[model samples]
Target: MDCGKRHGTKYFTVSSAENFKECMETCAAIVPCHSVDYQARTKKCYLGSHHNNPLIIASSFDSAHSVGCAGACGGGGCCKDARKDDVQEPAPLPDTSCGNAGFEFAFFPNDITYLGPNDGNFNPVVMKRTQPYYKGTTTRIGVTDAHIIYGQTPQNWEFVAVNHRGYLYAHQDGEYSFTAPIADNLSLLWLGPNAYSGYTRANANLEAAYTPVDSAPLEYKATLVKGKYYPIRFSWDNSGGAGYYELKIKAPDGTTIVDGTTTVSPYLVKFGCREAYGARQYAPWGEEN
Candidate 1:
């Protein structure tokens, strides 16, 4: 995306962007990119702050183009740079802590277990169901995140592949431990950028399975920043009858900040559309915001 006029020099650009979402990820790195414009056919992604569609001056149109915001800018929100050349105000910030709650849960039918790309069970046909064709949100994902991102959960719980997406706000900066002591069939947990971007069962930091004894239960330790939040993806599947997916995280102080027994620790939070309707809107991005 062109820095979208003004701003003097180009702030960000991706030579070979895989998709518009990649542009969002890039713009978000340097600034709070609230809007985006993408062309699938040309693999072109335009990052802007404009109310996007309504305010932007001009841009090429393509049927494959997708224009929307990631959080507040969704549902026909702007995808253009809304910054003024003279004003030079800072971008909006996300919540500091406890503003949003609960992890967004999604369940994929017919696939009860997760198989990484390298796993023997991994194949094209099994991955087809996880494509998310039904979505207006997720299309090429393998059982992923959010409430509206995947719509509604199936009524029946048994024999379904589950995906949990959210952010884990690190209360303190230090080494933190993650584990899934109670997981049925199979489960995978990912932290940091991979948790939001390209995530899969095989690359999970922590994997727990009833059958695959080789999969480790604990991720030892991962360093986090003080008051900073990292994207967390926890995915699991239940074969039949009864199943449970419990995520447990330990803070630097040795206290179980995220207790599986309690179900949800205040540290677990989900952002986006749900926030706008709440009393306080927390920052969906890192604490630095």
Candidate 2:
């Protein structure tokens, strides 16, 4: 069979077709087929795995044309930058007096064995925390002033799982380092400018041990812009053992944003889209309705 158009990688072949539309349909049925070049003279079709490929003049067909089958596929045309539409540009950094770096913590009982990864347990707690059986928000994520009973059972069997969500405000633009209290099971993640998406969730594990320092802390590094709230989420599980945790932030200026010994309070504000009449409506920051 003649390879029409002679563009893109060809991994499959459709033997026969009555017309161009039928040939195009066959290409659509294949998962990896991104585009197709049809030869009307011989009623033959060539499937390609790529959208952008140099055109080649094939003598076997009187006329050759290509069409993109994949969604957003350029179909032998110039490929457009898809990221421009998929990701939102960073908004102007707010004033320095915008807010502080803190997170809201919701605690749940892990009575049953947690079978999956640490993050897998996070969503369930977040969605069910307000439910009747859920234990509810026990405390803030910062350093605890006193011993807090996160969760407990009558039989002395205790288990506590906490999910923390909030923004980390930067005073100035520069590289920043973060560290959290080392625990038996802890997952800490920071989503900044380079990797912040409303639909994307951060899930980085930070349970590394420090050799010299006894207070081994989970650490992460990210370059942040001043007056911006970088979304962050952290999940910790004591697994029925001693539950003690703290959050610490070190700015680019070498100043400690939140010391391990002090308590950091959440902003007590919410932002983003809200559900209204089966549609999402943009709600201004700190605007509650």
Tell me how many clashing residue pairs each candidate has. Answer: 15, 0
Give the Cα error of residue 53 in candidate 2, in Å.
51
Worst 10 residues of 2 by lDDT: 273-282
List model 1 lDDT by residue over 103-181, tens digit each.
6554466443445432235221242235332212121122222222234554455556556667776767789988776
TM-score of each: 0.48, 0.44
Instruction: Give candidate 2 regions above 4 Å deviation.
Output: 1-102, 112-157, 193-202, 205-215, 264-289
Compute the lDDT of residue 140 as modeled in candidate 1. 19
User: What's model 1's TM-score?
Assistant: 0.48
Give per-residue CA lDDT, model 2, range 1-289, as digits (tens).
Answer: 1232344345366456665556656776778776666555677766657556424423332112344333333353212222223222232332223232233455555554444444234332332223223333322444332135333332322355555554554557898877775444443444542112232223353442211235656677888765455655555555443445555667788877654443433321122211110112112212211
Clashing pairs in 2: none
lDDT per model vs. reference: 0.49, 0.44
Report the number of the highest-TM-score candidate: 1
Best lDDT goes to which candidate? Answer: 1
Cα-based RMSD of the predictions, in order?
Answer: 15.0, 15.3
